[model samples]
Target chain A: MKKLILSTAALALVAGFASADVVRMGTEGAYAPWNFVNDAGEIDGFERELGDELCKRANLTCEWVKNDWDSIIPNLVSGNYDTIIAGMSVTAERDEVIDFTQAYTPPDPSAFAALDAGLDVEGGVIAAQAATIQAAFIAEKGWTLIEFATPEETVAAVRNGEADAVLADKSFLDTVVGSDGLVLLERTEMIGGGVGMGVRESDQELRATFDAAIQSMKDDGTLNTLIAKWEVSSQW
Target chain B: MFSYCTDPEALEGLAWLSCYLTTGKHMGLYISVVTVLVLLAITAPVALAFGFAGATAARSKFLPLRWLGKGYTSIVRGVPDIAFFMFFVIALDQGFEWLRHQVKCPDWPDAIRQGNDFVVCTAAKLPLSASPQWLHETYAFFLAVLTFAIVFGAFAANVLFGAMRAVPRPQLETAEAYGMTRRQTFWRILVPQMWVYALPGLSNLWMVLIKATPLLFLLGVEDIVYWARELGGTKNARFTDYPHGDWRMWYFFALLVFYLSFTKVSEVVLERIMKRLTHGQATSGGEAQRRANA
Candidate 1:
């Protein structure tokens, strides 16, 4: 009986370790530069490349899962995936729900893009992605904020005249404003801390593995190279 | 579309417009229309089969079967369908994972529902964690179809149940007088006659099913509505070869025309079907046709 129980316990341990080998990386796959789905319908962006490198360095097999921005964190916490590398910035409110690794990219300034110049930033309708730091910042500023599910819809709201302007990460708006008929507002505000990988609070061991990988990248300047290559904000 | 279209920026007028319409993302939009059609084709028959089962159960001599059928039909009638659509997809997904977790990981100790989070064991993950992108999409599409069928199947059941009752009591009595068994009467006499009565309600249900295809976007299937919003929105020069202003209104207009034409064709086809089903029947439609022929 003792031998049978011992063998069964050992088998269970092996099975547990086997299941832990593959880490699922959740991403919005809609945010450009940070992450977005390519024309061929695969997750392709800066984060995609960075996440792959982090998985390699950590010696963990990683797979990507595209989730909507609104449910990304909840899905991460709910065990839909193992980690969130979806350009999510570290915030106190979010930290309360889920834990984060070291910041992968430095804090990027948020800018407002509008069709017309000089719209009232205080009272006019401003669009932002729902549950984002920019959306919370706009709400704190007492602006009439219209929240959208994705970043593209926020820009669409500005162009469709539903909102006067849209506030999002500057790198995101830069591509939008460079196009015709839309211009970035002079007013830009930096909100939230640097972006980080989110892991469930229960998964501290997985978080430590990624944090070490991120720290090594930061130490060796490889992180900064990726930041520059992706045309994101300043280096760490 | 034109020979000079090689120079996108240099080309002016219709040439530029023609080339712009043929962008890769625009091809996705075209494919989405087929997605909607495929969904309708699959769901309609599945829902009809479900409705047939539910209606048959409702008319069964057994008490428990009748209550089960009644419960299925009436429960869905009480709530808005969009609410049902949103609720069932998540509920069913979690439900499946939970069932798998119980069987696959008997030794795992954590509670599956931790506060608002649903934490199933890694081994129990639906579609498995290592499944390809296409499998993930196919899984979501499968969930969307199941949700659509269940909700619409209840509505179809209600219509079919009422149609069964409308199949003239005397026709069933005639079957009984001819020494037919109850099951034989149901199959031979009642089933054929119910369709004539059910045709109008089913056609209306078919129209509702078409309009509800847009709800697939809510399930994250990237249907035509999603593609339209993505491609028709302002495309900056940095992101695309063909930059354009906000042309969402035009794209939506195109969707509007497509649905209208689809419904028009469906209406004509359904009318012809109704005529065929009503032929030689005791309905007003059959009587009018007979009078016209005389």
Candidate 2:
């Protein structure tokens, strides 16, 4: 039985497949302006545009993979995709597991949006998307934090009264605050260095390829143009 | 893809919608419906087998076996299915990787668990890092099926155990009186008659199992609920090709219709099976069937 089990596992291991040459770019399609699926049901947004350009510059064939935000990092680590071009922040904690290319977008302000202007954010229930920089910041402050699976849910939490306020990147909240009767809190916390592509630590070569592509985009002012067009964050 | 789908931005009306529904991501949503059904098909029988073993063990003459069976049913059934799903998937995944770590990287120097991370050698990664995307999806799906089987198996065992006992004591006595052994009596008389009693409980479990298929998203499988949420979300024109307002309500309504139709079909099939099982049995259903036939 032991031999049989081992042999079956070995057989499964040996059946390694797929085109190693095609770099799969994983993104959370729910996050708008950063990365989202358009009406044509195609991945669109700053990251999609930026990722395509980067892949082009790097001379790599790339495909998009839409993944839920909660498992994005783990999926990238598990080799479900070659890179996470999602609006992932560059943080020391995440750097322990995955290597990141240099920042493509400047450090975006993390703002709190509440139903009312003067809501006490410190004491009240705050919402943040799970596994995000804002969520970590909220947890570290020992504030009551309600974490949701998607960015939209965090905003919805504030609207539906499940949370007193939702803390997220200003780029994301800017679209929600004015339209949904959500008022941006005066308080803004700049948490991450910047948003960048995440690659597995072992893929230093792939990391280098993207890093170079990003650097070229930055140098030519094209990165800033895309960031300005999308209004994702502060331009370089 | 329709011919007009070639220029999605220009198209409007049903033609646009026809193209929109046929997009690659939408196809993923459609395929995920199959994923849910496939999960149901595989999990039901596996759960039944597990339940049979557990119920048999619960009634075992050996004290230890009875304790093991009872413990399996009670402990698993006591925990919420969601909690079990979240905990068990991670644990089982780590368990597999740990086993591989032991065999493949026995000489590794670093601790496996560091702070919040579960680090194993790259060689020990389940499905291996270089493996295909389908392999990753299949592995996650496999883990989900196992998790569902284990959790639902406990519920099934509870139902089957009650059903087994509900089989009349005199039926087993009759078998023993006819020179049959305890084992023979169980298989020949008790087992056959328990189905009529078990069907109602099992059918309820079947519905619960169907509802529980959406929890596959929590296990990282891109099942129907995930796609519904992803697709039905509002899209901005600045970011997407086919930007639209929130259509989650409509998408979820479609899911509601699908699940209702699915359960309706299941109810019809289960009713037929129950009728078949009740035929000539010493029960109210059996008696009714005989009377109707006469």
**Residue A165's lDDT in candidate 1:** 93
Q: What local lDDT does model 2 show for residue B20?
A: 84
lDDT of 1 at B272: 95
What clash pairs does model 2 have?
A38-B240, A39-B242, A39-B243, A40-B242
Which lDDT tens digits does candidate 2 get at residues B187-258? 999999998899999999999999989899887788898888888776655555576766788999999999
Collision pairs in model 1 = none
**What would the per-residue lDDT of candidate 2 be over residues A1-236, giving only the tens digit for each residue?**
23324544764657433334678788888887788776555788889999999989988888787787877887676555678998999999999988899999988789999989998888899999999999999999999999999887787778779999999999887766665577899989978999989987777789999989999999999999999998899989
CAPRI verdict on model 2?
acceptable
A108 in model 1: Cα distance from truth in Å? Answer: 3.3
Model 1, C-alpha of B130: deviation from truth (Å): 1.3
What lDDT tens digits, residue by residue, belong to model 1 across residues B214-267?
A: 888667677988777766666555545676777888999999999999999999
Clashes of each: 0, 4
Off by over 4 Å in 2: A1-14, A17-26, A38-44, A48-67, A71-85, A90-102, A110-147, A155-167, A173-192, A197-222, B107-109
Off by over 4 Å in 1: A1-20, A115-119, A178-181, B1-27
